[model samples]
Target: MIRKRKHVISIGISATFLGIFFFFITLNNVHTDTYDIARFSTAGETIRSPITIENEQETERKTRETVQSVPDRFNISTEITQERVNYIEEVFDAIATLESEELGEKENEDDKETNGDRLVPLSNQEKVNRLKQILSEPITESLENETLIQLIISPQDDREAGRKLFVENLETVLNNGVRTENIQSAISEINQSIKYATLNEELKQPLTELSKFAVVENSFFDVEQTQEARKEAASNVDPVVIRAGEVIVQEGQTITNEIYEELNLVGLLDGQRNFFPAIGLALLIFLICSMIGYELYLLMKENKLEKGKLISIIGISILIISVLKLVSLFLTSENQIFYIVPIATGAFLLKLLINERVAIIFTALFSIISGIIFNGEIAGSLNIEAVIYFFFSQLAALTFLTNVKDRTSILKSGFGVMVVNIITILLFVFLTFEKYDLIDLLIQTSFGIISAFLSVVLTIGLLPFFETVLGVLTDIKLLQLSNPNQPLLKKLLTETPGTYHHSVMVANISETACEAVGANGLLARVGAYYHDIGKTVRPQYFIENQMSNRNPHDFIDPKESAKIIISHPYDGAKQLKKYKLPKEIIDIAEQHHGTSLLKFFYYKEKEKEKEREEVGQIDESIFRYPGPKPQTKEAAIICICDSVEAAVRSLNEPTEDKIEEIVAAIINDRMTDGQLDESPLTLKELKIINRTICGTLKGIFHSRIQYPLKEAK
Candidate 1:
C-alpha cells in the first residue's frame, strides 16, 4: 500500500512537471515577434501595446538644446596691425624721392635701349596707380591729387612713432570689429582719428587708410559659447514624458513613421523579446499547478481517487491544452476570433470521466491559459473574447452533461453548450461595442457552433480509450457487463439456470440497497450478475442448479461435501480472472461470501463424528471459503443482499417484518463473522444498508393474496 501510494504521488509530481514543461514550451512559442512590416497601419484595426515604452530619444533631443550664451572669441594680430603703418610710411618716402632719382638718371644708355618700356617720367596720377597696384587695398583710383602729393612727402617714417600714433587713435577707433556692413563705419572711425592726429597733412590721409587696414574683425563665433547656450536651452526645456497607458496611436488613424517608431519603442512591434511576460506566465503556471495540486490532495483525503484515474485526468488536460495550442498557431492579433477553440471538450470529458466540480475549476484555469495562448497580437495580453466564450461554454457543458447516459443526452448537452457559446460570443461582442459586419458575425457564430460539436466529438472519440487504457469502470461499461448475453452470464444461465435466476434477484436487491447507502449501485448490480459463476462448473453439486431431491452430498463424506462447498468461491474468482473481468467483479465473486463457513456440510461432519461417538473440534478452515474479506462497501452490501434474498425465498409467507428480521440477521452475521471489517463502512452506514436491504427484500417477497381453489383444467 505504501509503495502504491508513493508511486501515485510520483506520477502526480511527474504530471505537474510535464504540465509545466508544455506550458513553458507553448509560452515561448506564443511570444511570436509581431510582424516586422513597418508599414502605415490604418485605424480600423485594433492595436495593443505589447511592451512598456518610454521617451528616451525625445527626452534626449529636448534636453540637449537649452544652452546659454557666452562671449565671442577674438583674434587680434598686433604685429600685422603694426606692419600696416610701416608699409604706408615706406610708400610715402619712396614717392618723395621719385622726382630727384628720375632727374639724376638723365636718359642713360640702358634707359635709351629700354625707352619703349621705362623712359617716361610719369605724372603723379600715374605714380598713384603704381602705388595702388603695390597695395591691393586702402588705395583706390578716386583719391585726390593733393592727397596723392601729400602721400608722397609724409614723414611718419619712424616705425615706433608711426605705429604708436596709429595704435592710440586711428587703429583703436577702427578695431571695434570690422565686418562687411561695418567696414565703412570702421573707415569713418579711422578718418576721425586721422583728423585729430599730430601728423603732417600729407601723412594724415595715407595714415588713415593704413589704420583702416589695421582693423579686422576682433569678435568671432565661439563654439564653446554656442554649445553652452544650446545646453542651457535643452536643460530649460521639459522632458517628453510617456505614461504607461499613453496611446501611441489611435484606431482608424494612419500609422506614420513616428508612431511606428513609438510602437517599436513600446515593444508592440516585432522589435525584441521581453522577459517580464515570460516571468508572469511562469507565475501563472505555478498558481495553476498549485490549485490543481490542492484539489488532488482533497480528492486523495476523501479516498475517492486512484493513481490511474489521476493520470487519466492529466492525460485529458494535456490533450485539451494541446488542442488549444494547435488552435493558437493560426492566430494573430488582428484575428481575435480565438473563441472558436473547443475548450468545453475538456470540461465535458472531465465531468463525465472523473467529475464535474474538478472540471469546473479546470474550466476556469483552461480558459485563462487559452486566453493567453490565443491572445496572439498582444503577446502575453489576455484575449477577453476567448476567456468569456471558453469560461461560459465550458461551464454550460459541465452543467448540462451530468448523468448523460445516452447518445440523445450527449447530443442535447452538446447543442446546449453550443448555444451558450454563441450567446457568450454575441454578448462579448456587444460588451466590446465594436462594429462588426454581418459576414464577420456569421463566421464567428458558425465557428462557435462548430467548436461545441467538435468538443462533443472529441469526448466521444476519447471515451473508449480512457475506459480501456485506465481500466475505468464507467456506468456504460458496468451496464454492458450486466447484459444477459455476456459469455460468462450465458454459460452460467445454460449450465446453472436456477443459480442464474437467484443471481438476478440478488442484482435487483443489491443495486437498490447499494444506491440507498451511497455505494456504486451499477457496480453492485454488475458484480451480482457474475458472482456465482463457479456453480456452472459443477451444476449438480450446488443446490440452486440441482433439479432432483436427492443430494450429491448424501453419498460423499461430510468433509468432502464441505470442501466442495468451500471451493466454489475460489473457483468463481479463478473463472472471472480467466475471463479478464474487471477487478471489482472478480473481487465480488471472491469476497461476497467472505470467510463464511459451509455450516450445513460442516454440521453434517459433526453429526457423523457424534454417530461414531468420536466427535471432536472440527477445523473451521476446512469448512470456510478462502477469503481476504469484503474490501469495499459494494462487496459487503452484496454479501448481505445475497443472504437476505435467499432467506426471504425460503419463508412460507414472507412479510415486511420477516424480511427485516432476515436482513438484520444477515448483516449481523456478516459483521460478527468479520466479513465487512475491511470495508470502510461505518456503523451508521451499516444500519442504513440493513434498512435498505430489508425494504427491497420485502417488496420482492411480499405476501400474495390467497384465492379460492379452482379445478385444474
Candidate 2:
C-alpha cells in the first residue's frame, strides 16, 4: 500500500512537471516570417543561420506604422468639371453679343449715313480679328491657331447650334473625369462625340476643336492628404505576426541572405524544435534524478530514508527549477545577465531541510538546469561559468549550514554565500581578461552577490511554510518547541511542577546522549520536555508530585496504581496529538518507556496475592506499560535519559562512579527488556550514550564545599 501510494504521488507530481516543461519549451520556440515573397530557398534545401537573431520589435513597429499610413482614395470632383463648362459657355456668349452688335450696326449704317456722327461699326473680318485678340492670351496658352479661332468666332448660320454642340461635346469629354495619364483618351472621346453630333461641317469642326480644350486633369493627387489617409488605414492594421513552426524558407525554394537571417533570428534555421534543446532538457532531468536517486540510495543504506523527506526534496527541486524557467521568459538582449535568478536558493532550502551533501547535489542541479534555461541568451545552457559561480556559492552556503540550529544561522549562511559569490564573480571577470567593460563587470558581479542575498531572504520567508505544511521538524522548529513559553510546556510546569522539573533534567540528559550518537539532540531535548505532559492530569498521584507525607498510592489498590502509572505515556501522546505537536515529540511521549513493567506496583500486588492466599501468579503482562518500543534513535535516547536522570537524582550523594554505575545499569536494564532492540542505535552508540549521560549527571550532582548558613540577613 505504501509503495502504491508513492507511485500515485509520483504520477501526480510528474504530470505537473510535464506541464511546466511544456510552458518552458514553448515560450522560446518562436517561428516568425514564413512567407515566401521572392523566389527564395528551395523546398528541399536545409536552411542555415547566418547570424544570431532576436525579435525585431523595431521593425515590427515600422511595418505597423507604414500600414497605418495608407491614404484614402479620391475620385475627380464633378464641381470642377461643371465650372469649366459654364466658363466655356460664357466665352461663346461674348462672341455672340459682339456678332449681334456688329450686324445691328450694319443695318443701321444706311439710316446713320445722313447723320454721319454715328460710331463706326467693324466689318465681319475686323470683328473676327477683334474677337481673336480678346481671347488670345488665355487661348494661346492652351491651344494653337485653329482651336483658338473656333473659341473666338462661331459660324454665322450655325452659331447657336455650334455653341450647343460645343457644350454637349465638352460634357462628354469631362463626364469620365480625366487625369494626366488618360487626358489623351478624354480628347479622343471628345472628338468622337463632336463628329457624331448633328451640325454643319463648319460648326462641327469648331465644336471638335472646343472638345480638345474642354478636358483637363481634375483629380490631382494630394501627397500630404494621401499620406494622412494611409496612416489612418495603417493604424487599424494588426501586426503581421508569424507563429512558431512556420516554414520560413519552403523546401525547394532558393534561400536568400535575408531569409537566412530571419530564420536565424527565431532559432528556426535548422528545423522545428531543435534536438539539442530536447537533449539538454532530458540530460538535466536524468542528471537530477540520478544524483538524487544516488543520495536516497545512500540514505537507504543507513536506514535513514523517509518518504516525506524524499517528497520534500523533489518538491523543492521542482519549485526552484520552475522559478528559474519563469525568470528566463523575461530575459532579453538588454538583460542577458540572469543574475536576478537566485541560484543559491535551492541550495539554502535543501541545506535547511536535508543536509549539506544533498544541498551540494541541489547546487549542481540548479546551476546546470539554470544554464540550460539560459543557453541561448547567455553563453550556453550548461555553461561552465554558471556551474562555477553556482558551485562556489552553494558550497559556501553548505559550509555555513554544517550544523545549522536556528534562523539566525541561515542569515549567517547567506553572508557566506554572498562572500563566495563575490569572489567567484571577480575570478570570472579576471579570467575573461577584461573583455567586458568595467561598468558591466561591476554590475554583473553586484547582481551575483544580490542573488546570494535574495536567495537567503527567500529561504527565510519560505522556511515556515515548508515546516508547517510538510510537518518537517527542522532544528529551528525543535528550538521553538523547546521554549518555556510553549503552551504544553507551560501547562506541565504549572500543573505538575515536580514532573516539569524531572522533564527538564531528562531534556539535558537526552540532548547530551543524542549529540554523542550523531542523532537530533534538539529533537530529543524538546521531546523529553513534552513527554510527561500526562502527569499534569493527576500530578499528586505520581510519586514525584506527592509532596505530602501521605501517598495517594496508599489509598488505591496496587493494580489501580500500576494502571495510573502506565497510562501516563499513552495519555500524554493523546494530549500532544490534540495540541498538534510534532510527531517526534508525541512519539517520545508514546514510546519513551516502551512496555517496561511497573515492578514496584507488580511486586506490591504479589504481596497482596499472598495475603489473600491466591494460588494463581499475578500476571506480569498486566502490570507492564503498553508496548511499542522506541522507534527512533532520538526516542530511545530520551527513554534512556528519562530513566537515568530519575535514578541518579535519587542518589544520596552522587559521585562520578555512582553516576557511571547508574547510567550503565539503566541502559543494561533497557537492553535486557528488549526496549532498545527495535531502535536504530547499536551497542557501540549506546556505550557512547552511556558515557555522555554519566558525564552530564556527574556535573549536575557534583560535590560542592559545605558552608555554614547565616542566622539572618
Candidate 3:
C-alpha cells in the first residue's frame, strides 16, 4: 500500500510539472510580431484621420460662444440706483403739487359758484390718451433710463389724474410759445419714449434682481459638452491592426530581445523555454501511466504483492509511452504525424497485450494528446476543430474493425480510418473556415485521412511485440482458451471424467445464478468449470471418483474425516494456481465450500464424546471448513449447487416437491448463519437461485424403477 501511494504521488507530481512546462513552451513559440501584420491586411490601405488636441479645443470654444449668444431681458446693475429713487420722488412731488393747486382752484370756484358738485368719470380711451399726454409732459426729465416705474392707482383714478395733469402740462407748454408742428412732433416723441421707458423698467427691474440671486454667473461652457469633445478626440485616434495568413518571420528567425519584448507585450512569451511542450508531453505520459496502473490493479487484486505489482506496471507503461513519444518526435516536426504513430501503436499494443476496451480508452487519450501537440500547426490553436478530428478518426479506426488476430482486419480498419478522417476534416473545415478553396481544402483533408490510415497500419504491426513482451492474457487469448480442442480441457475430460461432468453441471448453475442477479454470467460459467480441477490430484479420495467402492470415512475418526472434507477448497485453489488460472477462477475455487460444517461427522463425534466422559472438551469449529467466504453471488450459488447435487445423488427416491423442500431448507440455513452475507444476492434473487437449483436437481435425479419378470419364472 505504501509503495502504491508513493507511485501515485510521483505520477501526480510528474503530470503537474508536464502540464505547466508545455503551456509555457507553447506560449513562447507563439509569434507576437505576426499579430500587427495580421490585424492590418494590406500595405496601401488608408487609416481613418485622427482628431488633434487643437481641434478639440476649437470645438469647445465654438460651443461656448454659441451658448453665450442667447438674449436676456435684464441688466443686474442700476436697477436700485439713486437716480431711480430720485426720479420716483420727483414724480410724486410733482403730482402732489399739481393736485394741491388744482384742488385749491376748484374749491374757490365752488365757493363763488353757489353750489358744489362731484366730477363726472371719463371713458377709458379718453383717460388713457390723456394719461399718455400727461406722462409726455416731462416733469421728470432727469430720471435715469433704468428707473423702475409702477402705476399703483385705480384705473378710474389714474385716468382722471392723468387727464388733469396732461391739461396742466399742455397749458404750460403752450405758454412757452413753441410752434404747433414742432410741439406736436415733440409731444408724440415724448409720449412714445414714456411708454417704452415705463414697460422697459417694469421688465428690467425684476430680471436685474433675479440675476443677483442666480447660482450660475454664466450659462455657457457646460461640463457635458467638454466631455463629449474629449471622447470624440480619443475615438478618432488610429487603432493597432493586424491581418490573417501573414508570416511575420521565417523558420530560422532569431530569438532576439526585441522579439521577446513584443511577445511579452502581447502576453505570448514564456520566460522558461521548452517548458510548455514538455508539460504537454508529460500529460500524455501520465495518462498512459494511469491506464497501466488501473490494469495492474485488476490483475493483482487476488495476489499478495498486489500493490508492488501495480506500481511497477504504472512505472513501466509510462517509460514505454514516453520513449515512443520521443521517438515519434524525432521522426516528425509535425506533431500531427507523431500523434498518429503513437495512438496507432498504443491501440494495437492494447488489443494484444491488454483487453480491447483498455486499448480503445488508450487510443482516445492519445488522440487528445495529439490534438494538443498539433493544434497550432495543423488546426490553429487548441480549438474544437482539432479535437473533433482526432477523436472521430481514432474512434473510427478502433471500432470499425474487430479481432486483431491477423493483418487482414488491420488493413480493413485502415480503410475505415481514411473514410472517417476525411469526413471529420471536412466537417471541421466547413464549421471553422467557411470560405473553402477546393485545392487547399482537399490537401488538408487528405492529410487527416492519410494520417488515420497510417495510424491503423502502424498499430497492427506493433501488436505482436507488445503481446510477447508483456505476457498479457487479453480477451482474444481467453477466447482461444474456451475452444474445446484446447489441450488442458481435453486432458481434464479424458483423465477425470466424473470431475469434468461435475464441472459442466456447476457451470450451468453458476451462469444461471449470475445472470439472474445481473452479474457476469460468462465469467461465472468459465470460473466454475475450472474451480474444482484440484480434486483431480486425489481423485479416488473424493466420493464422485470412488463410485462403486466402500466408504473411505468408515474407519476414520469423525474429527479426522471432517478435516479431509474441509481441505478440498484449499487444495483446489492450489491446483488452479499451478495451472496459471486467473485469480477470479481461483477465488471461486477457494470460496465455493465457505465455512460449512460436515454435519454427519460432527454429530458422530458429539455422540461418541457423550459416552466417553462426564463432559469432554471438543472444538466444534474443527468440523467446519476454513473459508474467506464467497465474495460473489456466483460462487455462493455454486456452493449450494455442489451440496444439493451430492445430496440428491445419495437419495433412493426423489420428487420435485421433496427436492424443493431440501433446497429451501439449505438456503434458509445459509441465510440464518450469515453464509450468504458477503454475496450481493438479495432475498428475492436467492429465491430464484433456489428454484433454479431444485429444478435442475430434479431433472438430474429423477426416479427410475426396476422391472420384475415374475410371470416368466
Candidate 4:
C-alpha cells in the first residue's frame, strides 16, 4: 500500500509537469503572430513606409530644379533646311569659279611653255585643257546654283555665307570670257532643283511638335513610389505593448486588431490551444518519468531492496533528473546542451547505479523529453536519427563498461562513447541532412563524439557521490563487496576455521555450478561463503564447525535439533542484514535451505511420536525451514552446493564413486521434495549441474594410497 501511494504521488507530479509543458506549447502557437512582431518590427516601432510628407516635398523640389536646369530642345529639320540651301548655292558659285580658272591656266601654258621642250603639241595641250575643264565644270555649276537658291530663299546668314562665296567665284569665272556652255547648262539644271528647299520648312514643324510631345510626364503615384511611401508610413507607427496573462489571440481564429496591436508593442506572444504540441509534451513527460521509474525498478529488483530503500532510490533518481533538467535549461538556448545533459546523466547513472540496458532506456526517455522541451530543432521532432543515436550511444557507453572498476575504465568507456557517438552522428547526417558537406558533417560528428566522451567522464566523477548519498547497492557496490579484504570475511576465517574452510569449498562449488548455468558466478560464490556464517554463533552445534569433536546435536532432543537447524537460515539472514550485506546475498543466505526436511531429525521425531501417540500431530512446517525458495539459478546452486558438501564430508574414506553417488542423491532428494520448483533452472540444466558437481567432487575427493617410509640405521 505504501509503495502504491508513492507511485501515485510520483505519477501526479509527472502529470502536473506535463500539464504545464503543454499549456506553454499551446500558448506559444496561438500567439505566433504576436511573436512574429519581433521579425516585423524595428526597435520599439513597426517598419514604416518611406514616402513621408518631408520626402514628398523634397522630391517635388528636386523635380522643379531638374526641369529648370535642363537645356531647351532645338529643331534639327529647320536647321538642316537652311544649311542645305546654302550648300547648294555655294557649290554652283564654286563651279563657275573653277571654270574660269581652267580656261586661264590652259591659255597661259600654251603661250609660255611651247619652246621649252621642242614645243608642246597642240593636240596634247588641247587634251590637258579639256580634262581640266571637265573637272571644273561640275564644281562651278554646283556653286552658281547654291548662290542662286540662297539669294531666292534669303536663308540664314550662316547658311548663305558659303553660297555667297561660291557665287562670287562663278561671277569671276564668267567675266574671264572663257566659253563654258557645258558648265552653264549644269548650273542652270542645279538652279531648277533649288525649288525643293522649301520642303525642309514643312517637315521641321511636325518634328519639333513630336519632340515636345516626347517629354516624360510625372505621375501622382507609381508602384515603386507607393512601396517607399508605405515603408515610411509603417516606420512612423509606434510599437504596441502587451503584458503577461493577456489573451493575444484565440485558437482556430483570425488575428484581430487587439492581438496585432499587443503583438506589435511587445514583439512577442505565447502559443494558444495547440493540441498536437500539448500531446507531444505530455507524452514526453510520461516517457521520461516512466524511464526513471523503470530504472528504479531495475536497481531495486537487482539489489532486492526493501520498500523504503526502493522509494528512496526512486525519489533520488527523480530528483536527479529534475535537477539535470533545470540545469540544462539554465545553461543556454543551445538545445544540443539539453540532449548532452540527459544522455550524460543516463550514462553516468548506468555506470554507477544500474546496468547499461537501464541506462539505454533512460537515454531514450531523455532524448524524447528534450526534443519536446527544446522543440525538436536539435533533439529532432520524431527524429529517427536522434532516436537511433541515443540508443547506439547508450549501448556503446554501457557495453564498454563491462567489468569496469577503476578510474581508468572511465577513460576507456569514454573512448567507446566517442566511437559510438561518431558512428551515430554520421548515420544521422547522411540519413537526414540534405545539404551535406564532408567537412561540416565531420565537425558535427566530432562534436557529438567529444560531448559523449565528456559525459562519460562527468558521470564517472558523480557516481561515487550518488552511491554514498543514496546508499544504493549498484553493481560497482557488489564488485566492492566481492573483494577479499572485507572485514566480515576476514573475521569469518579467523574466528571459525572449520566453517571458513567449508565456506571456501562451497564458494568454489557454487561459483562453478552457477557459471555452468549462465548465472552470476561472483555473486553466487560471494553469497555461498557468507551463507552459513551464523553457524559461528555456536560453532560446535553445527557439524561442519565441530573440529573432530563429538556431535553436540546427538545429545539434544530431535525436535530441539530440528529447531536449531531451522533457525540458522533466519539467523544468517539477520546477521547479513546487520552487516549491511546486499539484499540479494541475504536472500541467498535465507532461502538456500528452502523447506527441505532434516532426515535424521525427522526419523528420530517419528520414533518419538510413535511412543507418545496421544501427543498432538507434529508441525512438519516447524521442522522444515522458513523459506521462500531459491528464485534464481545462483541461489539454487548455492543450496545444492551446501547440501552436497555436507553429505560428501560425512565419508570417512571418500572416493570418486562415493562422491558422485552422494552428490546425485542430494540433487534427487531436492528435486523430489520440490525445493527446486520455483528456481529458473530447467531439468536439462539441472542434469548438467549435477554432472558438473559430481565431476568436481570426484577431483576433490580422489583416491590415493598412503605409503610408510623406512628409517635407515
RMSD of each: 19.1, 21.2, 16.2, 15.5
Q: Residues 190-291, candidate 1, lDDT per residue (tens digit)?
A: 678667766666566656656555555543455775666665666677767654335566667788987787767776664346566666777788888878
Query: Any runs in candidate 2 off by more than 4 Å, and if so which?
Result: 1-284, 300-304, 377-381, 401-403, 433-442, 708-713
lDDT of 4 by residue, 1-713 (tens): 47546655654554455445434532332222324443323333332211111233334455555545444322223333334344444433443554456567667767766855333434433433443454335333433332333322333442344344434433333333222234454343333333233334532332222212211111122455455555555455443323233444444445555445444443344334234444655565555556655555554444343443444444434544454445445433222343344365466565456455555665665555444344322211343444556566666767776665565666677778778777766665567547766776666776676677667666776666655555555656667776768876776777678888888889888888878887778778888888887776776787767778899877989988988888888888888888877777898988899888887898888888888885666678767886888877889899999989988887898887788788888898899999999887899999889988887887788877788888998
lDDT of 1: 0.73
Backbone collision tally, model 4: 41
For model 2, where is the 10-residue window of minimal lDDT? Answer: 29-38
Work out candidate 1's RMSD over C-alphas: 19.1
Residue 534, model 4: lDDT of: 75
Q: What is the TM-score of each candidate against the true structure?
A: 0.66, 0.63, 0.54, 0.57
Which candidate leads the pack in TM-score?
A: 1
Q: Quote the lDDT for 361 in model 1.
A: 83
Cα lDDT of model 2 by residue, 380-495, tens digit: 22446656676677778878765567788788888888888878877876786547888987797788778888888888988887777777667788888888998998999888
Give the backbone clash total of model 3.
18
Query: How big is the positional error of residue 32 in model 3, measured in Å on the Cα after superposition?
Result: 12
